[model samples]
Target: MAGDSSFDQDKNKLAEYETSSSGSYKSSRGCFNSKTGELMGRNFFSWIKLLSFFFIFCGVMSTLFGLCMGIFFQTLDYYIPKLKIEDSMIGSNPGLGYRPAGGLGFKTINGDYKGLSIYSSLIWFRHGGDGNFDRLRENLDKFLEEYEPGFFANQGASLTKCDFESKPKLTDESCEFNKEWLSDQGADIKCISAEHYGYYYGKPCILIKLNRIYDWFPDPYDINEVRNHSTMPLSLKNDIEKIYEEKCDDDPNKYCPYLNMVWLHCDGEDDPDKENLGLVSYTPFRGFPGYFFPYRNQRGYLSPVVMVQLKNPTPAVLMNLECTAWARNIRHNRLKREGLVHFELLMD
Candidate 1:
């Protein structure tokens, strides 16, 4: 046959090359299933772009944790340390006043009103009148001409002259004004004059002091555990056992006893009435006393004047005074109370 017709034309070209490779492998698996559905739609937009970058990284870490707790409670009062009491550290409970005399607004002396009015130095003088004592003596004479070398040496006073009649000559043994050990304890040195006992007794003689604190101490075993605790005050524990039997010979650390105790209470007296004339009488003569010698930063260390003499005050009437300083760990009723010093006197 012609070689059996060339083997049936090579078996019809091997069945037309296997049906053209089975339609080219089903069009290359439909172009690899459209590139595997475009790589599963780019892995579902990369999981919604990684969940929108994890909610923008938790909204920038919760806005930086609420701005660092609002800047740490807004500087927590210049870093926590106001009227500390409770485990004794003693050093920042100072501030007590009364040096205005008649300078902070000089309200009147010869004409009688003697200062304090602008609604009584803005309620700090407490209260008096005459329609605000000419604006409380022109804002207390512009605040005593801006604290004039007063406010306890403008608040630092490590003793800058309270000399009281010359007494400083000790070659050595560290003697910076001992006035002969405070005149060997009879104590009456005297030399803190801002001269304003209402210019010598026409009434308002307020010169109370104490407002310098640099190296404060007061913790001789917390003042004998606050004078043998029991909530003290049996007349202040017999005045701290008569200041440890006449100045610490009975040894409560040999002396540092009267840690600050001044108490005047005109309208709140337990027994005031010092010769009532519309009542107002005081007498803490010459500086607070008991025993407090350890100033340390002693720049000639001298801060012991507390004078208070307001007798016969009743010209226009408006007393209500209160000065308290008693200390156990120096707290004075905390904060803006700084251990008390309210005022209000109207001796016309």
Candidate 2:
């Protein structure tokens, strides 16, 4: 009987060992192990160590990236462009634009002119008392507001009065455009804003300007260049020469920037347009001043404006008016409208 009790005792101990071993094995594979009290195969301490390592690694990498970016940006000027001239998106050639062009103008090109989105090149309005000059003049007023004298002055930004004689020389003075510059004592005086930009006189005024190119300045035409230019209009050439003779013809090399302006020429787009379009006049100046450029993106720098007056255009006729800004650096590409702008003009 004592031998039988010993065997039973040993068998009971063996059975107890097997049950405990099974439980240990299951716990090792579960959410918490009974022996180590670990969660998801890792103890709390081990998890904390791993998370700390990852967090430090990410923080260091992010800090290094941000520091590098800050260093890179610190080298650049906010006001000046990093890329300019040929490297600029505007290229070496500046583009041409017109005023009262913020939104699409009423058009009749077999398409509705209602959508506000787009190039906005059309300028259709009535010329007489019963016409739609109010809309055109209002648009002009808004457009010219920035050109007013106190605009940049009030903002603490300034421009310089630059001349065309020297190349790429920008001064510290603000070249503010005054509305009084457009006033004339003669019959052509109708070009003033008080006269509703001459829309009331059937002599509407058009404002022309060059699209700004960063650090890009215009190289004005010399007497030889203008006289020998292959495609320049005869009338434009003559006008330029007359101005040159009066202003700076004494010195062959030195040209007055105010007088030595980038010449502007406007006429009919086609033979029919030329025939229907009447006499036109340029107010203040014929072209944008050479001194206004190499645009440093100066605050309150007003681009020079040329006011054109269309006098006695054939009533009730649709005319395709094409205007071009001339300079040595400005390439004339009709297809791309580079250095040029085209607009439809009609008066009832």
The digit string of per-residue lDDT tens for model 2 on 194-244 reads 788888877778888888877676777788788899999999999988887
lDDT of each residue in 1-348, candidate 1, tens digit only: 999999998899547545664454345532322423423234567768888999999999999999998987786665234444333354466656654534234346576555443334212232233233343334334433423343334233343322212243222111222322211122122212322223233334354556555445443233566567673345445545554465444555543433333332223222332223342333332234423333443333355544444545545444445555555545555247575565555454
TM-score, cand. 1 vs. native: 0.23
When summed lDDT is taken over every stretch of 10 residues in candidate 2, the lowest stretch is 165-174
TM-score of each: 0.23, 0.73
Runs in model 2 deviating more than 4 A are 1-69, 102-116, 153-172, 249-259
Output the TM-score of candidate 2.
0.73
All candidates: CA RMSD (Å): 23.4, 9.2
Q: List the residue pairs that clash in candidate 2.
A: 159-173, 159-174, 159-175, 160-173, 163-257, 164-257
